[model samples]
Target: MQNDLFYQELDQFNLFSEFAEPQHYQPVPNDWFVVITDVVNSTQAIQDGRYRQVNALGVASIVAIMNSIKPLKVPYIFGGDGASVCVPSSVLQQVKQALQATVILAKQQFSLEIRAGVVPVSDIRQLGKDIRVAKFQPKDHFSQAMFDGNGLSAADSLIKQANSQYLIEPVESDSLDNNDLFEGFECRWNEIPSRSKEHIALLVQALPNEQFSSDQIYQIVLMAINGCYGDELAYHPITPKQMSLSSKVADLQNEAKIRSGFVGKLTKYKYIAKLKLLRHVGNYLMKNKVKTDATEWGGYKQRLVENTDFQKFDDMLRMVISGNEEQRVQLENKLKQLQQSGLLAYGIHSAPSALITCMVNDYNHDHVHFLDTTRGGYAMAAKQLKSQLATLKSVE
Candidate 1:
């Protein structure tokens, strides 16, 4: 498989409206493979107040893959608890190897179970599923691929199949040598507080129907959401008031996973001390007015604001928002109406803080971060909606 050939084909695609009709999507080639990565027991971890770690592990899985296949853009989507991405058949083996190490890295370094697997496009097509590609160039600095087919959703379900041979497993020994696959991956940002002092993590999927299409249902629901709370900026979960860097060693110790030996304790303290220094560095750079100051901290901070992944589509509608009590009530009221009308399935969770996860391949640019409601909010909501849909099926 000529990997460069994959990008050449991808470049021919023009930007498309995210809200366009679903059937208009272009089918992905049968030669490509879909890769899925997710955290096992993420809900329990979030309940233990480790949602930040869960979010970071989710981002780290993609960072490891992208860093290994640098200069070659692949189609990927970020789910709050995990992710789904598509890569050419040529790079299949390398992608799996990197993920094997990532599985180990997340377990050893973060005590988290990061499940991963790859399924072929041909296999999914045989199941009567499909995948389509669309490019979203949010800014010159960043671009993302939006998937709108059942193939990815199908692949995700199969990868998570119990005891499936395709799922990547932990190595027998602790010396699998992750080879720093996740180098430069950072989750140092604090949980951003809502400016409105209220937040809602939202997830929805239009129930498949012959009477109305998923796209139509989604547009109606999205319009209702925006009409009530506002667009990304008006009810943005992370505000300047919420953007603060944390030096809390408690979270850092668990993430870095300092060795248990005496030397390991010293190394742990060293990392903690380093974070303290980094905090001061952040404060100094943020306060500096001149361009030639400590660093271009001002520009980077602005970029974080610009790059927030507030809402995205991956065969489903997902969002995280900060809204006032009045706005939340209105949004939920409309959601109830939709439920009664049977156009969509929805789930929601709220918390005091909005979680942010970073993907930094380039310091100056070409990097982005994702935001989700605290504690695997989207994942939790998806589970609830699935349960409701199941009940609906049994009754029918």
Candidate 2:
């Protein structure tokens, strides 16, 4: 019966593969915009030794504000200190209103100062490339500003300058050569920190992906919580001997703040919570024999379909045991298909069974893979679609 189910999954995998060739070029819309918020004088706050209280209050405030705005359907990102949000243009005014309200609330409630900025996305493809580049070149001015400097404050000024120079002009066609865009922008901002260059790259990339039209004023915000700036630099334990005295002090302050930060508080507790949840879910699914979420199931299937790495499949077998019978059957079917597709190499089958038993017995496998397989599959699909769209750019 398992073999039959597995073969059935293999058949489905083959079907998915037939349509997988063009998974690289998904059309990302251009209506998305970014809102950058930072805390003013964060470095000074850390130096003053109020980093812990400030971060806790700041993150809590942000979370509270975000929860209030959840009805608006805007997705947001929370970086330890501050946050960046991407909102569709249709809701731009609403987002601005919410931000403004939050700023006012921060002042009244926490005595924290807040500042925010927004940038409309035009090409996501370019943005992804730019992010990659920026990640690789961290020493540049923009990177420094983002990481430690006052670049967030200056981002609006730079955007305004770019607008004056016609740098914000829309592309004449929907299709654009990402390489050309990267090179042109890089040359245009050669004097700027490589970080800024990468920032521009991300903007360009977000443009195509979000299908942005017309110039939009990017909103920037700075938030100071518990009498300290929330957006400050991350600190490393190791300090270089040649570092300046001022730099060393700054790093020490940040390290101290992190020790007492919200992340520090949540780390151990959250880790345990996740392990328990995954194990419970994994066992439930296995016993009941139903499929887990389609998004997750489809994602695992895609890895095999695309012939990509299969290590991603390891997580599902962990917490997947607790799903209903229907879910278990679905998972079993999916796994069988993977093995039949020649994707499962060594011990995937045994792993799931062992994982199920471990979950039932409450053993000590605490490793919970956090990557959402379902989301990964969608991303893969989107990339394929984007690649197809890139072809259209060449024709244009």
TM-score of 2: 0.29
- Cα lDDT of model 1 by residue, 294-347, tens digit: 336667777777676777677777778888778888998898788878887788
In the range 1-396, model 2's lDDT, one tens digit per residue, is 132121112211122111212221122135555555544454455446444323433343334333334434333322323454444565556455545544543354345665555664453233342110001112121000011111222333334443332122222221222112111000000011111111000011112124321111011101111012121121010111111111123222322222222234354245344444544564454345445434232222212112211111100111111122343244345433433333221111111110000000011111111111111121222233345346545755
Candidate with top TM-score is 1
Which parts of model 2 have CA positions greater than 4 angstroms off?
A: 1-28, 57-65, 68-74, 123-396
True lDDT of residue 232, candidate 2: 18
- What's the true lDDT of residue 225 in model 2? 12
Give all TM-scores, in the order shown. 0.89, 0.29
- Score candidate 1 by TM-score against the native: 0.89
